[model samples]
Target chain A: MIKFSWEFHAAIENYKRMKRIVEFYVEGFTNLPDWARSVWFIILLKLLIMFVIFKLFFFQNKLKKEFSNDEDRANYVIEQITIP
Target chain B: MFESVDLSLVNWSRAQFALTAMYHWIFVPLTLGLGFIIAFMETIYVKTGNPEWKRITKFWMKLFGINFAIGVATGIILEFEFGTNWSNYSWFVGDIFGAPLAIEGIMAFFMESTFVAVMFFGWGKVSKKFHLMSTWLTAIGANLSAVWILVANAWMQDPRGMKFNPDTARNEMVNFWEVFLSPSAVTKFLHTSTSGFVLASVFVVGVSAWFILKRREILFAKRSMVVAATFGAVASVMLIASGDSSAREMAHTQPMKFAAMEALYEGKTNAPLVAIGLIGDPQDDPMDSTAHEDFRLKIEIPNMLSYMAFLKVDAFVPGIKDLILGNKERGIMSYKEKIVRGYEAQQTLVAYKKAKKEKSADEAVLRAKFDDPQWIDNYFKYFGYGSYYDPDPLQLEKNAFTMIPPISLTFYAFHIMVILGGHFFMLFLAILWLLFKNKLENNRIVLWTAVWTIPLVYIASEAGWIVAEVGRQPWVIQDLMTTSKAVSQIDTSSVMLTFFLFAFTFTALLIAEIKILTKQIKIGPKKEGRKQ
Candidate 1:
């Protein structure tokens, strides 16, 4: 009973901390200056282009794309390094 | 030979990485230096309880926020390129390289981001003392982030504390502190961060000069100038010392790069440092000793290069010819010999792998060769040179010449950086003296000079990077991996497409940042009676 009660208190404390952090960021975003909105738009647009357009369509990791397993990838790299 | 691989793929990959890195560098130095300047302004505000100081701090802080956000965006792209563009290099040195970057992300970057929120938004919500602490911590965190990346870059320039594991086919870190505290790492970090400080100082002074020129905010401009000029002067002095130390370190660890920086073609004792000169076209052969006289016009500081490199005027400095060809008396192994030894090392690895796989008796002996310190230092150290090995004697000579970096680019970039460094040092002192005499506003030339220097400082900063990166061409990690060998086996078209994507996005974002920044500056700080 004692252990259960202590655990219950700890979980409640953790919930409060999580709530506080979320509130902090939410408030920060809401309170941003007028100019920051434009900045955020630029940042999000860049991220979208980089992650979606560039990374997805073009910049796939060659090792991961070519070989499904780590062993094969390692073997390929070793071959590349040693064959010359 | 691996020459059958598309050469264009390597060129495109290199061009893409350089593009991202250079663009990323544009915002980083400003963040590093301005963070501290803002902190100082806020400190004065807190100590004196002055509203004016707070206004100044807030104005600079606004600019810092713009730069910091863009810097983070570009920096993330740079990190991702390692996996996307240079996967082989990522795997080979990932063990040694990833630690610092991971630390930067987990510890320093997180700390910076968390506090940056508080520093930006906690104005009226948080206690004054807490806000001040957050600002200072943000500055420290920004700089701390720089320390790790510079350490990683230094490891590339002078690889240390790592050993190759044949089974894994990767270089693994043996000593973490050795990588962290390497002489190259120390000098590079000091030189780079201080240069950032100098750049930021120039930025602040330039902006402040504009306000004075327009005959608006006289007191505000003078106050900003005082702080920036004082910080800049100190940082510039340290920059000079660190640059000197960096040069000396380069001479020792990266002799090829150091030789290229000065356009030295012939090895000699008491080498004269080129103060200014017009370099003619590179000779048909770097081995031609008479090529030194090809400079159209020249001015030199006698014995300074030798003294700067080795503290002794009579110390022998090897040149391009000596490094590429042989210098038996100086004990410098030629590229041809290095390639031969490197090929042997590569063959030895291939044999060991075969033996181990077959469970042969030779496995033990071949594996022991890797474990032997002398063998590793002498043979394995030149492993990357194997890529240039050719069976034909004439082709071998041609391959050796390819080891010479773009001498013209390196030399011009280095000299431009040095000249600008000297100019900034004097400019800062002059500005401070004029301000002290209360003659700054009347002297339109000085004000115009300060205003113009903003762009020049950026040029100077970029030039410094060009020298560091371009001077060490043909190497990704010194003596271990060549740039061509380290690139991912990807199609040139894919790399080119992404390069354009990044180019378009970064340019657009840069324009946005400039527009937003100028708009804010034009609006100026909130009036004295207004709430921040």
Candidate 2:
């Protein structure tokens, strides 16, 4: 019979145990410390402001939005590329 | 160094292509991996009738759209650049290389564009099973596109299933299926795809870890981490395995490139792999003007490189010096002979063209001489050598081998990739352990580590390319064409201007992309009406 290394199996078992324990511990995450919760609000607020600026100012995609037909969209792109 | 040649044109063309390709790469990998993640989330959502899974799926899908748009935008430029900046190369191998690209556009792209709309907009518009199928189809389409592109790239590196036609002045495909099933293409696709998966997994895990750290979207963050860690572990293992096979393939097909990657300049039976340590400057040809000899410091794994290349404990592996210096015993000829032979072949072609143009009496004989099987084989073998720029042919042949790309870049890039691979193994193991223990929220250090690994994984992906592309120096199509010769006959200044134009435009879009992606992640999965 071919013998495999004990450490290999043992390590796998140990990992399995750790994974099992953490599977349930992660459920306790909904309730958090005030600091963690507050930081999230700040991150979200910053993200919202950035998103608004982007939506309003950058990446308008005028051709896709304005042109209903493929030919028109194609013409716009070619004209843009061709224009001096 | 820049005195007597059209240096600026070649440099700018290379720079321009590199700029587009690198930017395009940043988005392609993300698209490849994220498609599957979103699809999996949606599938689960459909199966369980759980609105929370749908929320998770929707959140990721938004980021995927942003990345996919940029990838497409940059990809169009890449294809156009091939026509504009590399016209000579386009015509040279157009017959053989153009097929896969055409297939990619038709078969893969149409499938992706069709289903992606359904995936994004058909949540309530379509049946659950239909929507799930669309999501899966979108992912399959994205990966299928990758297959064709990599197949095209693999042909350049390996260049099989094709023979050079002097009369037509192009390479014609001998067999389409053989090129499709090229061993290099398979390994490249697998390696690239697996790494893309790893990149996506890490990005998902990192962002989820951030959410957990900030204590927001608790259910979303934990569940996402679980999916990423599990999927990541499998892909990480596959990534390493595919990389091994890819390296062995490179060793066989492009031995000089493999040697440069290892910084091995002399052939040896018990070659050591340089695991870590800094080497001298690339230009510093200390001691025999070879990369291996220029090493100032290094810690090498004895006989490891030989084992990796040959799967033997003590197998002889030739280094750059052995290849450059010519090993008669090993039946290895030097670059000098190749350069001369290449020049002779070019001369024959020029004469044949002139003869045919003038309709001279000896035109038939000249054509016959050029087409002689053995002579043509040698010509094709050394074709890249003709691209050398020295005015004196003898001088050019003498110094050609000295110009096998920058060795230091290849060496360091390889080391960084290997180190990152090691880190990924450990990181995936830890994340899995934490998930098993259900302590993902409590482990602040581990959570933060996962969060920061996003940028590191990007660096690792970039390094992988550097190893692959830069390692194969001089040759654009290995042994067939040099990069210098493949460039279009455009003026230098125009290319430089266009390069900057692209650089500025891409950077702006890149900034917008990052901002939008971060914003979406900060929003997290929306609150579901139904519970899991």
Candidate 3:
């Protein structure tokens, strides 16, 4: 017969106890006030901030002027128009 | 429970789907990216009336056509596989999943395919402005296709905006907006689309660089590089930002996965992200028990995980050990167990209700018997512990099935993609600065960097996908249906034969694509004065 030590049993018990505590903590959130639900709402706020920063600051004006010569020449010709 | 599955059949089905999906993905990114490139080229043509720009647009369009054809071919098989290999899954989630597929066909597919025809054939037949509009429409169509497909895929992973329909024995869509606005759907779409842009940019830059290296079509190469580098720089940076948000979303929605990705076993505040480590094979029994003994060798950067997840250094991200242990105590079963328990619970509840309605004392006694502590315990124990205690019975029943692939590969692949993305962001920005200073053309190192980074873009796209699809394993639809339950009742040998045939044909087409692309690259984009 393989004999298990008391210490191993104690460790298992401790694990079970810790697990119970964590469960209680999570369960507490279920009955939490509306304010607590707001904590999860922060993720949405951050996403908006990221999108604005990405679109406005990062991607804006970053595209290269590949056909600048033709554009510039066309603009110059338009600028020289005498009659509307 | 009566479903019969041969191991070889299941394995072959899985292999076929995986292979086809992987191959299809190779073309998908190029299509998304090149579509945008063509749109921009046409925009330029419209604005400037430059014939040279028009010529460049036509040149790129040819390559896009080749990629589009392959993308369509491989994509057809994926939709068919859901009905064939995963018949049970299709029936289970068909109410919810099928909606997006139908929408894709009606809305996105029609828009893209119709415009694609016009874009390809309408150039000479229609006015220039009309042709340009057609190009833009095609680009939008491609992205629309992405939107619908991703909407369907995202529902599988997270499964929001839906309700269970007992009448149909499947989940039905309750809110279309919820499905469309799912956190996973948005982040994944942006990240995937941006990756496609990166791939397209790199392809253009690489081909152009090759042209310059040979000292042929110098002006064309120079122009192409400018456009490619700009798109590459912006897209690379955006990929990092979107990837960061995607990771954070995963941390919130799928904490176990986030923990797995970081290889965390314990709960800790300000957890450091690990860049790379040898993850011990968890399938090996003795090895798995000792897996965490010397598990994490090094923390790549202290508090990196916290920063990524919470955008704050002191923020906490829970580990797998914490999540699993926490769930066990909470009586929260594993996803598969939960599904089974849910079914059993529903059945028992129905029986109880029927007994009450019929006013049958014996039936009432039977229903009340199920409510007894011993009976309830036995039910859970039989369903849950039966696999552990009696393995043969469990084997007889197809209790385990995963639509998602392995985690370890996806975890590492995601990290590598992020690291590479960061590197390229800096490299492209530096190259942009150099180009502005007129020194980029003269620098051998910068030119070569542009050349090599082209393939890195595709690698990153593939890795990102592996993370997305593989991370959502075991269920075709999380908490709703198992993949084994989903596979169509087909003979195993038949699928295996078809699998080999597809693999061969796909390989041949891929080779042909490469040969044509290589020959074109060597010829250097139809130069006016340069000799062949």
Candidate 2 residue-wise lDDT, B112-204, digit = tens: 877876775565657899889999999989999889889999999998888766565667888988898998999999999989988998998
lDDT of 1 by residue, B1-532 (tens): 7775454988888888888888888899999999999999999999999999998999899889988876676877777788888988887896788999888878665889889999987887788899999999999998998899899999999999988887777889999989999999999999999999999999999999999999988898899999999999999999999999999999999998999999888898999999998998666643433446468878999999999999999999999888888899999999899988888898888888889889999999999998899999889999988888899977887788888887888999999899999988888999999998989989989889998998899889899989889899899999888888788887788888888878887787788778888888777777654543
Candidate lDDT (C-alpha), each = 0.87, 0.76, 0.64
Deviating ranges (above 4 Å) for candidate 1: A1-21, B1-7, B285-293, B528-532
TM-score: model 2 vs. ground truth: 0.82
Worst 10 residues of 2 chain B by lDDT: B283-292
Candidate 3 or 2, higher TM-score: 2
Task: Rank by lDDT, highest first.
Answer: 1, 2, 3
Error in Å for residue B108 of model 2: 4.2
Pick the winner on DockQ between candidates 1 and 3. Answer: 1
DockQ comparisons of all candidates to the true complex: 0.49, 0.02, 0.01
Which candidate wins on lDDT?
1
Instruction: Please state the error at residue B450 of candidate 3 in Å.
Output: 2.5
Q: Better model by DockQ, 2 or 3?
A: 2
Model 3 misplacement above 4 A: A1-84, B1-8, B278-290, B293-299, B327-407, B527-532
lDDT of 2 by residue, A1-84 (tens): 124677788889999988854643443235433323443454354344334543334323343446687445433332221111
Worst 10 residues of 2 chain A by lDDT: A75-84
- Native contact fraction of candidate 2? 0.00
Q: Over the full model, what C-alpha lDDT does candidate 1 score relative to the true structure?
A: 0.87
